[model samples]
Target chain A: MSTPARLQPGDTIGILGGGQLGRMLAQSAAKMGLKTHIYCPDPGSPAFDVSNTFTVAPYEDADALDRFAAAVDVVTYEFENVPGPTASRLHAKVPVRPGVRALEISQDRLFEKQYLTKASVDIAGFAEINSQEDLDQALQKFNGKGVLKTRRFGYDGKGQLMIRSSADGNGAYAALGSVPAVLEQLIAFECEVSVIVARSLDGTCVSYDIARNHHENHILKTSTVPAGVTAETLNTARRMAEQIVTGLEYVGVMGVEMFLLQEDGEERLLVNEIAPRVHNSGHWTQDACLTSQFDQHIRAVAGWPLGSAQRHSDAVMENLIGFEADEWHAALSDPNACLHLYGKSETREGRKMGHVNHIKAKALTEGET
Target chain B: MSTPARLQPGDTIGILGGGQLGRMLAQSAAKMGLKTHIYCPDPGSPAFDVSNTFTVAPYEDADALDRFAAAVDVVTYEFENVPGPTASRLHAKVPVRPGVRALEISQDRLFEKQYLTKASVDIAGFAEINSQEDLDQALQKFNGKGVLKTRRFGYDGKGQLMIRSSADGNGAYAALGSVPAVLEQLIAFECEVSVIVARSLDGTCVSYDIARNHHENHILKTSTVPAGVTAETLNTARRMAEQIVTGLEYVGVMGVEMFLLQEDGEERLLVNEIAPRVHNSGHWTQDACLTSQFDQHIRAVAGWPLGSAQRHSDAVMENLIGFEADEWHAALSDPNACLHLYGKSETREGRKMGHVNHIKAKALTEGET
Candidate 1:
């Protein structure tokens, strides 16, 4: 829970990253009569196209940061990669929603694991892989198989490597630029799910229906709503998300990724990662709920009450990767689809250009379809 | 029916007249990955806040019009006030949707009435009022009550006068500077409703669910959806909307105002006026349907098939008029409400600064006591 600072409708909401998520956030902010000023380093960022006000300088540029801080009423970011120093700088000047402490835990895998451990949250077996000897020791303990991820600055299957045996552990450690890393025992999880929760500065929190995601080639392919799970598993997922966010005193929307693991007849949830801002998996909120996660993020950061996170219908969100956005018109003509384009000019493989959401009532005879 | 041309994603859709409607239309265009270039006389027009490009010059500025037309694929205006010469200037270069002919008729009330009449559409009885003698003659045939409106331009109850008596007519005519006017015998009506119809170049027509309007101080106060009309009336509204569009060979979206008259024991509809572009009455489409009227207009003008005009939910949209915008914060706090601001700097009395749309399930049982 954080201070309950109220914001008026015309308040300027400051966004720190300038990707599709931030672009959507700015759009949502404008829709609610709130102005948005985007602060990002990329001079050609897509979000800048829609937002009239922006600072085109690096996050660490003090002059630009100061100007951005002075212009906006509240500050929030689209990604956890926001360096802790930059967050601290802005927090000193403006009400930085989600706060600097949340960034500290999310920016580093080690810090995230440490926070989860102190909260008695479940996680895969792991250890810090610093020295070559440390990798060997962890590899032997985990049946000679484990994943080594950079302690900080890793995303989208980058800055991480899987080592099946100690034979490649030495090579895998170097593949990570020989940086300080966290080693984790790989879990054969049955499925991956995410809970997107919005916690306002007033301590009010609302969680959307969990979504089961399927990734292809290390990129999110599709996400289905009403993720089939027992009531106990659903409640556990919600409680785990609440505990992590409340413990971090986070504000705005936060996504907690988890592994749905099953062993014989036993089933439980395991913490995978945490996003301090809105997650791609929650894109379904734009069509399936009364309020979208991006809109909820703006509302929460603006000191407005958290909106209904309840799902209105079963939904599926498919990411338009690379040139897949070329089929936008066809998707738009589909009676069951709502297409969204990010207005990005450049197209390259694996770049998330846009997404589409389909909301429909879940079939009554649903199994594992 | 004009030839339907395929407009791929990222095509430019040029819009003339940069008022609030154009501002909203530009935003909807950006959401679809389409570029919008707003051409308007006022440099401070609100639509410039969201459009990618803009040209600020008078409508008669041929140099500006040529550049505007050359820079975009198709041209449409936000208001019918677009002069005939300006439409011709653009039409000579770019293919203007809902072309100059429609613009000329819409800008002048006399031409609009004549066209509708030629199409066998029913309308309130009216006579031309030019001189004092003509006013006296019109008053004689008025059956003791009438409304006189300027034939060139009138909106939101402006440029129109109520002729309660011949004595009042002199004062009204004098106030109007005795401009060319049309006199209409006042008719008793049940409710005021508007039909927003979209017609593609190929004559693919689609009309949104009718919007029942409530006026306060002669300005639109609220628009309610589902209009709560009999099936027969609804079908007629759609058919009439289509007929008017097809008659003019109009492309893009046009708003047709119709009077719902319950004369004797039967209900009838009368042609009132037409807006040759995206309209305020259709603002509810943003929240109440899968496809917004503004987006539908861009689609049609871009030569794309019209999206479904399905009403996703019954809605009530209320304008935050004048100083009523002072309650913006309260409106933003409502979970059931969606607020949209025009980004206008001033909020004088009777000026439309913003609007709020509330979409809820239709009150299934009428007269619930």
Candidate 2:
């Protein structure tokens, strides 16, 4: 099919998931005078509160997907776990950005590792496990220690088991519903970092400053910019991101999470995973950068030129998990805090409710750099 | 009624009028995890695109107004011209912010001038003209040169006629549809500037830095921060804004436009007019300041504590008039430009389509101060 023309100001964007990411993308789309029609199975999706229109139906409903595709000029999803058949059906009617390949690779951990290795990017050693014996054999290669994860539908530490020794791998395969999985060697990294990068339809790519992330209970808690890594390390992270996007022929923002390993007093970067959509680590851009990851993603998917990823201030973004958002009153009292609370009706434990960005003068931070 | 409790996340803010101002307000409300229900007469209202829910009914529809009031925790308006009866009706049901007093005073030029004078704020010389003779007499006091404006419902140079001389006064009263009008002495001032201030429910007030304004055909064209006024003039402007909000017992943001007169080597500020809602001149705050005018207005109306009104960078905001938004491509190519399109369907002449904020390093601009 011929390349779709660029979206005009009043055109509508069809977002495939109605979560906080889609909600933010809708807000950014509105800033550019564009409309959004969110497609989600849950009627109570947070993004539904801010979209121009929405369809409440399961992703497998061809009838609902067809109507959604007919209503918008282009289609983009907030999450990478979109069913392959669903994406293929939408692609037959309209463009599904980040394309089927990006989605297919990101949905399965083995495919992601293979793709990264093919692109000459460093990644944790991994082997696909189709049976219990496959898991036990892989563990031996990694000194009887590895993270066995389901090849699909895993997020925020779900669908995974950490095997510290051979005995720990006994029922792991059956415990994960006996589905296809991959065992990845667990590396002892100095710290976790992520690079948010965007690529335009024209193949031009840009990356924001590296964000040093901290995780609690296997969930991201905070992302601090100016990751304080050496200049060479920063460049390597950015180059790896650009290389991955280029290899995928991607046209949108992608979050590349990596491990910074300290070996012989030098920094080494390894690709941990790739999210083919806007990621949580980039939320600070909304308050600190010239263009946010959400805005960049929309611009790229709409076939518009990508904006500057330049940050105007240094920021530390902290996610408000569940009941923590109840303290929003205290967050508002800070002069330097920019709070964002996703309009989730219920504050279920372990659910992301919102985030706050604490901004500091750029000059002060740059001096330290 | 005793003070209504502060709005919690997920509470809806009922916004009257569905224009760009309301659109921005809805976006800000969404950022704070609040929902918005837009009330507008126009079915094609731009704000409807990003709102949780909306009612398309005229202000005079009491039943519709009552339904809207029932759905929201509080109500606020985009424009100051909310009819007295409509505001009173909503006020009876839900807490209407900035209060009906701000609306009643700002809706009429004569009442606004009188209210400012009573608040001990200096304003231009003016008089209320009820008849042709009154117009003829009022012009003489200003040397037969003044602006004849309708007492109510005037905006963007409409319902206004300049009486340059005695000949200019002929039929001026009839030209304004024989409505009650106000004739004010026209000041040939050095420049126009405005201060955007927000007053919280607890009566704590805060003001953003003055923005030097430039207008084209009476519509705001650009607003530059670091207005370059003397330190004393800056202090006086902030004090005047604080005094106005306190005297009106206002909640939410107000834009106070003023004239900077170079009477001698020093500068003097005279209050020109006040906007009861977010003003065009404050659009720069969205990109340059820690807390935007729209966000500040929502915080005040919701009874939440105010965020900082601090500017992180210097900025010049220019409005995109009519077809100017068609050139969004060019605006996007500028790395420092933050473009905001209003999602207007048609580009009629003299219509505001969007705006772009060009940011610069704060240190470079602050050094000039």
Candidate 3:
């Protein structure tokens, strides 16, 4: 295929989904003199505040999607839950970065695992579950301990049921609404980590340093950069992310979450899952790195050259969920803290309201592995 | 007066002047979960693209101003050129930050110099002139070399004429429209620098490190942090900014420009003027400091505590005037560069199209003085 001309600064980039991520993405796009048109069903979407225009419509609205695609030079998204047909239709008109393959694989847990397995990338053993019998068989492989997640439409630990023992198999299967699912073996890991990588249209790829994550209530609470993993393990993780991005022929930023397993003096990383867009774990980059992941994603989607993913500072990023953002007053006075609040209309439980990045110059020693 | 209640995350801030500065201010406000309403006469003002709502009407439009004030919780402006009556009207309806005093002082150069002198701040030898005779008298004090500038409504080297000798006094006066003006003695200065400071509603103050500025064609071309100045110079600059903010009882961010003159191996600073809002020289703070000047402005105007103004990196900020922003492709791939472009549709000569901040960790050695 012939390479399309790179988008000029004045080009309009159409974004699918309207959330904090899209809001930040739109801001980054604006910083490059690029206009954004966000298309989302929610009129109160935070991204609407920062974009040039927006279309309030369901993702499945073909007419709206067609108009949106035709109006912009390129298309990208803030989340992977976009309907396949909607993406396919948009792709038929304008280029969609991260490509449809990445979205298709990321939306379905089974497809993600299958792709990783095919690439020889290490992942937790997973079995497809279409019925109670499949769950029963899958439980035997995990010694009756596993997580049954719906093949599609899962996020923030939702759409997944954990099986602690064989007795919970049938109930767990039913909890998934009897939908097609994948059973992932429960792995006792040391900690969770993620790598945000960006791939330009020319196939050049760059990954940020790994981010060590801590989750509460199935939602990420904090992410610290320089993950405290050994150089070997970090390198392995970066290579894995690059391999995945390459396999998908991606042309935008992707977050690959992993489980870092400590085994004696060695550390092993198991691919947890992939988010085919800027991920929460990468938020630290906004304050710690010269080129933020949002900026990198915009560059990639615009077919511009990829930016350096090197971080300039060590940082601890903590998310403010729901009313926790009420502490914004304290953050305001913090000399080392960089606060970013989504223009959310209300504070809801488990809802990400904002985040704070407390940065320190790199002179501070990295965390001990 | 009882301290006005601190603005909450969902509060709206009404901004006057929908330029690039307002655009950045709006983005910063959104990052704090605050909505912004921009009011400007220019329908194509860049800020409208990022704000939640905007009014394309003259500042003197009482109906539009009243409606805008009613819609927002508080009012702030991006430039000092705001009409004093417009500010008073807004202040009467909603709290206008930095207050009308800041606008009244900063809009007129004579008032600004008078305020600084009253505050015991050092300033260039200046004399108010209403005619050619006044200009000739002012020239006598400066050895016939000085700059004649309109006392109000002047920016970017506009509305000013150079008086190189007493013989040119009449022509200089006519060149300035024979209007009331200020004649400033031309001081052979080493360099120009600026200090950006913020003051909260409760009187808390914070200031960023000095920014050394370079001008071309009387327009700021670049700003470098750390200023390559003595520690004493930096401290004095900070103190001057603090004194000015306190003197004005300002409740928002302000930029104080000064000339650094080296005499007998000692640096003496002469106050040039004040910008009663975010200044172009402070653009480097976005990449070099923990909290950007725009972020601090929003916080102070919203009655929130001033954020930390600590610098974590050394940076050089270069402006992209007009067509120079077409080099965006180079900035896209640069690892150490952070680019910020105003969403301007056209590139006019001398128009501030964007800026690029190249930063390095503080561990890097400072440049030679």
Root-mean-square deviation of each candidate, in angstroms? 4.8, 3.2, 3.7
Residue range B1-369, candidate 2, lDDT tens digits: 334759988899999999999999999999999999999999999999889899999899999998988899999999998989999999988999989999999999999999999999889999999999999999889999999999998999999998898998999899888999999999999999999999999999989988999999899999988788777888899999999999999999999999999986889999999999999999999988878999999999999899888777788899999878888988888867888999988899899999999877442211111
Docking class of 2: acceptable
TM match of model 1 to true structure: 0.91
Q: What TM-score against the true fold does each predicted structure earn?
A: 0.91, 0.95, 0.95
Give the alpha carbon lDDT tens digit for every residue of A158-224 in model 2: 9999889778889889988899999999899989999999999889999998899999999999998
Candidate 2 chain B, run of 10 with poorest lDDT: B360-369
Instruction: List, in order, the clash count of every candidate structure.
Output: 0, 0, 0
Task: Compute the TM-score of each model's chain A versus the native chain A and list the values.
Answer: 0.95, 0.96, 0.96
Report the lDDT tens digits of candidate 3 across residue range A1-369. 122448887789999999999999999999788999999999999899899999999999989998998889888999998899999998887888878899889888898999999877899999999999999988998898998999999888889988898777867777789899999999999999999999998899999988899999999999987688777888899899999999888899999999999878688999999999999999999987777999999989988887667677788899999999989878877867888999788889989999999887643111110
Q: What is the lDDT of residue A149 in candidate 3?
A: 92
Candidate scoring better on DockQ of 1 and 3: 3
Q: What is chain B's TM-score across the candidates, in the order shown?
A: 0.94, 0.97, 0.96
lDDT on C-alpha atoms for all candidate structures: 0.82, 0.91, 0.87
Question: Ranking by TM-score, best first?
Answer: 2, 3, 1
Write candidate 3's Cα lDDT for B95-131 as tens digits.
Answer: 8888899899988989989999999889999999998
Candidate 1 per-residue lDDT over residues A1-369, each given as its tens digit:
223277776678889989988888988887776788999888878787677688889888988888888888889999888977888888888889888988988889998999998877788888998877888888889989988999988888888888877777877777788899999998999999889988887787778778899999888889888787776787788888888888888888998899999878777889899899999999988876667898899888888887666555567899999999987877766655777788888989999988988756321110111
Error of 2 at A198 (Å): 0.6
Q: Sort every candidate by DockQ, greatest first.
A: 2, 3, 1
DockQ of each: 0.23, 0.42, 0.40
